[model samples]
Target: MNWYVVYTKPKWEKKVAEQLKNSGIECYCPLITQIRQWSDRKKKVEVPLFNSYVFVQLAESERNSVFQSVGAVRYLFWLGKPAVVRDEEISVIKKWLDTSDCIDVTVGGYQIGDSIQLESGPFMAQKATIQEMTNTHYVLVLESLGCVLKMKIK
Candidate 1:
């Protein structure tokens, strides 16, 4: 089975994940807790880590089954094909989320403007180009993904 990214309706990640699981599809919707405040009180609520995305592991022949879950819009497409996430990437996300304190990530001996492949954590396998290095962070440009990730050094 391969893991595919599912695009879901806004604010429906958790609900769709639950429905998929009940139907025997292995799905993951990573969540984080944040302090949401009203005018009178504060409460910690769980929110989707990546809004509108849920990961589902299934056989390619079973791809259409995901649509049975309400709020699942479609499979995310990259390069005109269904985006396939590596098993290591899924494991990394699970491990990172299980830990409360963010684990230490080191950029050993790498200088600014170096191109490197991450080997550890949830960002593993992401193509990154060094942008700027600071005492507290590593600014990386992910060209393939067309985004800059400002990662904090712990």
Candidate 2:
């Protein structure tokens, strides 16, 4: 048996995992407790490590049970089919989730020679070459326009 990704309805990961577990399907729904601060109080809430999804282990023969038995599983994209999630990618995600805190990571800025489409600020809707990358910004040179613009990327 291997882990398969099951997409649940928005904000239904915990519910789905619980339902799957009750149905005897092994499910792993990693959760983290985050402190929520208010004006005069603080509370902890268990949130899913990954939003709107849970992992299940099943055999090829039992794959049908996922959709038939569990109403939570909306669809599964298999090999050579539409929206197929690669096994290697899933393995990497599992490995990282095992070692890390499993929070969403967002990366900003552009790499060298990466064609960038500027969205906002003075250089809005401009395409420029990333000349250099600094701590929080990139130096862009608009060759055709003969203008240099430094944009901050958060």
Candidate 3:
């Protein structure tokens, strides 16, 4: 069985994953623990690493079963077919999430005007250009998205 990505309804990734698993479907919804702060308190919470998406291992025949699960939107399609995720990619995600408490990623050796791809977060797989930089942060211009982002690298 190959791993395919499925989109879920807003804020429903964990719920959909649980429902699918309960129905004997193998699903993976990676999560990261983050400390959220309020005026009076800070608490650690598990949030979906990739919001609104879950990975499932199944054959073509099992697609309908997964679709029937609550909050499942649809499979992510590439080249007019359901996108197949490589095992190595899944392994990398699993390993990173398993080992890291708080993760920070930075790409070095990229010159100004060089395009770089974001590997994770809300802009996963999106390309942006290095516009400016300092010792601790970068200013990226996302041309297609029509926005500029200031992100820290640590």
Candidate 4:
């Protein structure tokens, strides 16, 4: 059996994982606890580390059953074949998640002038450009509104 990543519907990572497991399929959906603040109060919530994706361990013959599972969209493909994840990579992710309280997963390398967006904050949904970066801060320019904001990296 090999581990393959399955893309799921939005906000369905956990649900799909559970469904697959109930059907005798081994699935892994890593989650992280995040402190979310609202107007009322702050609460710790478990959120999927990889949104809309779940890793399933199965043989190639079991692919059809996984695809038939609820909320499972499809397998993540690379070069026309389903992408296979090594056991070491999965173990590393599990280890890091187990040891770290806060984890930042940077998807790709970013350079100056790259377009970025604020995932969460007052400026949520706002798009900006990476103007400059120092050892401790990021200078972002909100191009749509002609405003600049400096944020200290934590």
Candidate 5:
């Protein structure tokens, strides 16, 4: 079975993961504890690391089975096909979260959903969208290349 990306309803990642698991499907929804401050107090809550995205491992023939769960709207597509996540990449994500090697990163100007143009490097002059910003990497989607880039930032 291959791992495919699933697009869920906004703020429904964890719920969809639990629903998938209840149906005997193998799914992974990475979560992180974040501190939220209210006017009166602050508390730690578990939130999905990737908003509205979850990974599921299943055979191609069983792809549609994911829709049985609520909030699973569709499979994320790349290059006209369902985006597939390699097992090694998934393992690395697990390892990264488990390790306490996080460094404080101060990102200036750019934000998620921003369109950026590269001025140099291999993809120089190409335009990409900032899909995510993590402690060690900037996740970008180069539409022209039909690929996602996890560029490590120092």
Candidate 6:
């Protein structure tokens, strides 16, 4: 069996996986806990590594069942038809699930002047400049009153 990525409805990773698994399809939903801060305090929360998506192990012949049987599942296309995630990617995720470290998916082609918010740290809530972009983080610059501030965002 090969692994295909399925895009699901918002906040429905578990639900979509359940529906697929109940129909005899194997699925994987990896999650990581991050510290989220509110106006008052910080809280730890678990969130999906890949938002609104899950990976299912299925043969090509049985792929259509994922869309027909799992109501929450929306599509499985990458460039064209169903996209098969690389074996190395699946293996890395499985290893992280066993060890429980933070996991993330990279979004490509993010350009300068693209609107972005700081995901964490001291610069939270202040509008900033995406001075530079990298595979894992951005070089952000912020202006505080009359002074300049800078930080890296991941």
Best-fitting candidate, scored by TM-score: 1
Q: After superposition, how far is residue 87 of candidate 2 from its true place, in Å?
A: 8.9
Candidate 3 weakest ten by summed lDDT: 142-151
Task: Estimate the Cα RMSD of every predicted model relative to the unseen true structure.
Answer: 3.4, 11.8, 5.8, 10.1, 7.1, 11.4
Give the per-residue lDDT digits (tens) of candidate 6, residues 1-154. Answer: 8888888888888788888888888888877778999999999987887778788888889877888554455556666776777665566456645764343424346677655554543333545555666655655554321113332334
Tens-place lDDT digits, model 4, residues 23-131: 9999999898889999999999999877888999999988889977879998988779998887765775577567744433232477899998867544556688988
Which of the two candidates, 4 or 5, achieves a greater TM-score against the reference? Answer: 5
Ranking according to TM-score, highest score first = 1, 3, 5, 4, 6, 2
Residue 101 of model 2 has an lDDT of 35
Give model 6's clash tally.
0
Q: What pairs collide in candidate 6?
A: none
Evaluated against the true structure, the overall lDDT of model 1 is 0.87
Tell me which residue pairs clash in candidate 5.
none
Give me the overall lDDT of model 3.
Answer: 0.83
lDDT at 144 for candidate 2?
A: 38
**Local error of candidate 6 at 46, Å?**
2.2
- True lDDT of residue 86, candidate 5: 78
- Against the reference, the lDDT scores of all candidates come to 0.87, 0.64, 0.83, 0.79, 0.83, 0.66
- Taking all chains together, the TM-score of candidate 5 against the true structure is 0.69
**Model 6 TM-score on a 0 to 1 scale:** 0.57
Task: List candidate 4 segments past 4 Å from native.
Answer: 100-154
lDDT by residue (tens digit), candidate 2, 1-154: 6666677878888888888888899877767678999999999999886677677877757866666444475554556442433344455445644664333322265577777766643334556787878777667776533336554555
Error of 4 at 109 (Å): 16
Which candidate tops lDDT? Answer: 1
Clashing pairs in 1: none
lDDT of 3 by residue, 1-154 (tens): 9999999999999999999999999999989788999999999999987778999999988888997788999998878999888776677567756664445767689999999988876456767999998899889886543347676777
TM-score of each: 0.77, 0.51, 0.72, 0.67, 0.69, 0.57
Off by over 4 Å in 5: 101-154
